[model samples]
Target: MPVTVHFAAGPAAWREYHDHLPRALADAGVQAEILLTAPDPAAVDYIVFAPSGEIQDFSPYVNCKAVLNLWAGVERIIGNTTLTQPLARMVDPAMTESMVEWVVGHTLRHHLGMDLHILNQDGVWRNEITPPIARERPVAVLGLGALGRAAGEALAALNFPVMGWSRTPKNISGIDCHSGDAGLAAVLSRAEIVILLVPLTAGTENLMNAERLARLPKGAVILNPGRGPLIDDAALLAALDRGHLGHATLDVFRNEPLPKGHPFWTHPRVTVTPHIAASTRPLTASAVVAENIRRGEAGEPLLYLVDRARGY
Candidate 1:
């Protein structure tokens, strides 16, 4: 019997994944029927999910084996009481590569003080301030997930002293991994540049409060490609005002599209990017979804399965 897979990731996503997903399933040797709408939820063997979809309640999907997410972040849907099936988050290779590129590019920009020249075109030549090489700069990456690990390793490869931190202890070959309160303090204290890539979880919300931000060495830079609420907005602004921090290059925010007239837009020390860090490409993301479906059918362990208790 062919497994029934419903595309509940919305019309736009349907358009993006319609052809790619089916082709990926066929390539993975899965016989499945793809549906744009779930007229009969009970018959659905799997659901390709995104937060934008109409299916908020998953209780009706009695026979559903799993919910396969299209994007890497699962904070929006993880809190749903209706979701009971085993959930798998997307771990697209292309997305990981894009994140690593963004992190490295921005880290270099700040490390080399490129903005001092790029933003200023005046005739005055300021060659007195020379930037240090990559090895001399101590950097920290505050997450160890697929995205965080890749970014940290790339920085380490560049000879930037890389320290990685997580809520739970993690061991990565190139990264100087840290955990617990003391470990976090140790990583933050010496890091000349800090990059945040941690997931949005209860324990991590406002992870960089006033006290933690104050712990950073004076003139240290922050690169947040991770969750928005991880840093308290008021505390960050205050830190910048006090000159305790150098600058912040943010890719994500608590309020997306960041309303006009927001202080961050006008803040001299803050750089707000429109959440373009990484995106799931159909070619790679479809393969991840298809592989999970194959695993479900064959009773094999699914890839990137969500740990509900941890809220990632």
Candidate 2:
């Protein structure tokens, strides 16, 4: 029998994946029936899901082999008590490439003080302030996950000294890896520009609180393309207000479409991007989904499986 793959990632996603997914499944040699609505949930062999999807109860899909997430971050649905099936997170190459490009572009923007010239269009020549080259700038990446490692390596290639810290120790070829509380502090202290790409979890919520934010070298810039609650808003505003930190370029936030009254929107030192750092391109993302479905049928190990204990 062909596999019954239910596309439960929502209407917008359905529109994006409807065409690409079938082609990808064909390429992977998987015979699957893609369903937008499963009248008999128990018959579903797999589920392609997203946090915004309609299906909140996984108990109905008794025969489902695995739940394949459409996005990289799984914090939204990870704690669902009803979700018993094995889960896998998306790790699309196109998404990673987009993240690296955004990180590198902003890192260089802050490093070169492009804002100083761009914002100050007053006919005055600002050649007096010459920024140091990439080699002289020290950068730290707070997460060593796929996206983090990719961004760190890209910066490393540009001669920026890259230090990476993770929940546990990692040994990426180009990154100077660190782990544990002590390691985080060590990396934060020396970094002139710090990038936040850590996942959101109870232990990591408010990871950049006032105390930790203070550990950064004075005039340090922060690039947060990761989770929003990772940084404390009040503390960040305070740091920027006091001019202790150089600037913050934030792509994610605690409240997306950040409230009109929120200080971050008006804060001179803060750059608010509409969570556009990276996105799952349908063509590439569908292939990842297709590959996993193929593996599930072949009884091979599924790629990017999520460990519930780790809450990634």
Tens-digit per-residue lDDT, 1-312, candidate 1: 989999999999888988899999999999999998989999999999999887899999999999999978899999999999999999999999999999999999999999999998999898999999999999999989999999999999999999999989999998999999999999999999999999998999999999999999999999998889999999999999999999999999999889998999999999999999898999999999999999999999999999999988
RMSD of each: 0.8, 0.7
Off by over 4 Å in 1: none
Give lDDT for model 2: 0.96
Candidate-wise lDDT, in order: 0.94, 0.96
lDDT by residue (tens digit), candidate 2, 1-312: 899999999999999988999999999999999999999999999999999998899999999999999999999999999999999999999999999999999999999999998999999987988999999999999999999999999999999999999999999987899999999999999999999999999999999999999999999999999999999999999999999999999999998888999999999999999999999999999999999999999999999999899998
What is the alpha-carbon lDDT of model 1 when measured against the actual structure?
A: 0.94
TM-score of each: 0.99, 0.99
- Return the TM-score for candidate 1, rounded to 2 decimals: 0.99
